[model samples]
Target: MKFATQLIHGGPAVDPEYGSLCHPLYHSSTFAQQSMDHFGRFDYARSGNPTREALEEAIASLEGGSTGLAFASGMAAISSTFLLFSPGDHLVVCEDVYGGTFRALSTLFARWGLTVTFVDATDISAIGAAILPHTKAIYLETPSNPLIKITDLRQAAALAKRHGLLTIVDNTFMTPYLQRPLELGCDIVLHSGTKFLNGHSDVVCGFAVTADPEVGKRLQFIQNAFGAVLGPQDSWLVLRGLKTLKVRMEQSQSAAGQIVQWLESQQCVTKVYYPGLPSHPGFQVHREQASGAGAVLSFELESYILTKRLLEGVKLCAFAVSLGGVESILSYPARMSHASMPAEEREARGIKDTLVRLSVGLEDPADLMADLDRVLNG
Candidate 1:
């Protein structure tokens, strides 16, 4: 089957027991013992649930991986994946990473002795230079958060292999629909299903998928031990959201392209960041890897005063923290997403105070432009 078909029929779609179109939601805390000789495939809800298993299997298939594990939230998946490494192990990570991931590494993981070296991953050589003798893996985020920076996945994965290091990519921005890191020689792929994967913004979930069985086994153990598995209801919701992934992404991206063109034409906008733009730093590299530029873009104003006016004056788009919902969301990264980082560090990463990130929704391009135009000119 093709990619679009895979999204709907990727995993357990129909109820095997009743032939219902939707997968049945199994809410039991524990399963009954059929025989005393051995436990069934599902012994307890914490270890497994039919509904949750369906969602996990779907993500694994969508990501082209051998195994998939679900978690309560994006941070849970990230934290549990970090458990795969031991104390004293080193990792090389992208510089403009998600703040929650940064907090986990700089605070909790660092406290446990898991050292990390942050680099501008857009320059693949910077990542290579940061690799220490004990470096176990290289983590990356392409078309990175708020800033919309892109990292070349194939080159980064090859570099990791030469050093006998694992390549773990956070595939949240592109989703499996647009980019599959496992196909590019990466060992594992992670996602915050709260974003585009869930699409509706109602569910908070995460996934860890890997094509390697050994890595899959370790992550499965960590997920069960941590007991932060996504609940059955949220699992079903994500499953429902998966069916419409292609259409939603296409429409939102179309609107985003128009908005990018408008933002560039505006006199007040100082700079814009988007992979689809020809002038974008990694435009060609992104084209070679992912199928789309995605619906998110970032732009900077001449001053913080203009930034505040644009953010507070916007009518249609909600000035919010999260992205990837059907509704347009305008975010201030310096104060919203990257607030955890120190001032100097955020500035060094180029997450400026005047930067504004936008996640284009399914609204008409002209309507969104008018809303933004009214806000900017008013």
Candidate 2:
């Protein structure tokens, strides 16, 4: 079936109990059982809920995974997955990974004795060199965080399999609509549903998807034990937002392409980092692995003065903390996204002080470009 059709009909068609088109929300904390000898499928809301189950099944179908586990937030999902490894185990991660993940690894994971080696994952050889005998997994973010560097998912996942290590890819930026890592041989795909999947920005939720039943069982156990499962209301919100994902992604990507072209002509903008552009180093590789370039892009200004002006002067695209909504967002990476990293570490990873990231919205391309021009060149 086509991806667009899958978005609407991939999971449950309607409310099975009521025959209603929309899935019914079960708001009760606990389900009553007439007999203690045999209990219902879902005894507690944390363990399971009808509303949450529907959303989970939808995400699993969209990502081509056998199971999907939801969490309170993106970080909670990531942290719980990391806990799957024992204390002595090691992991090799991308150098420019999201700041929140980096903070968790450097602080909490470090204290727990789970070591991680940071590498330039764009170079597969670098990943190989960093792996240790105890390395249990390879974790990465393609079109990585603020720098927007691309990692070859196919090659990386293959490398992990050869080493008997699990491969985990964060699919928040691309979403399942643009990229399905499990289909590309990845063991796990993670998403911050708060961003694109919950396109309205009204919900904060996360998902961990896998095709392997054993891994799914383990994740389900951790989700229940950790007790960070997403609420039924937020789960319904993400499920509803996911229905229009295809259209929203297409419109946002089209506007991003136009904005990339306009940014190249401006003297104040030093460089544009977007996989869709022909000049991008990963353009060909990205095309081979993913269906689209996605809507998020990062750029650098020639100087701090110009960067500050563009971020502060923009009226249309709000200078904000997060990305992937109907409204455009202009974020300062040095402060907003990658601020958890130390200044020196951020500099080494090429997240300079003048760099800013943009998450294009469904706004008209001409209007978005004009707003940028007024700020950068006025």
Give the alpha carbon lDDT tens digit for every residue of 1-378 in model 2: 898888888866876677987778788889999888999898999999989999999999999999899999999999999989999999999999999999999999999999999999999999999999999999999888987788999999999999999999999999998889999999999988889999987888889998797999999999999999999889888878998999999999989988998889888889999999999998988899899999999999999998999999998898998899999999998998888999999999999999999999988989988888887778
The residue-by-residue lDDT of candidate 1 on 46-146, one tens digit each, is 99999999999999989999999999998899999999999999999999999889989999999999999999999999999999999999999998987
Q: Model 2: residues >4 Å from true position, as ranges? A: none
Candidate 2 clashing pairs? none
Give per-model CA RMSD.
Answer: 1.0, 0.9
Which ranges of candidate 1 are over 4 A from the true structure?
Answer: none
The number of residue pairs in model 2 that clash at the backbone is: 0
Q: TM-score of the candidate numbered 1?
A: 0.98
Per-model lDDT = 0.92, 0.92
List TM-score per model, in order: 0.98, 0.98
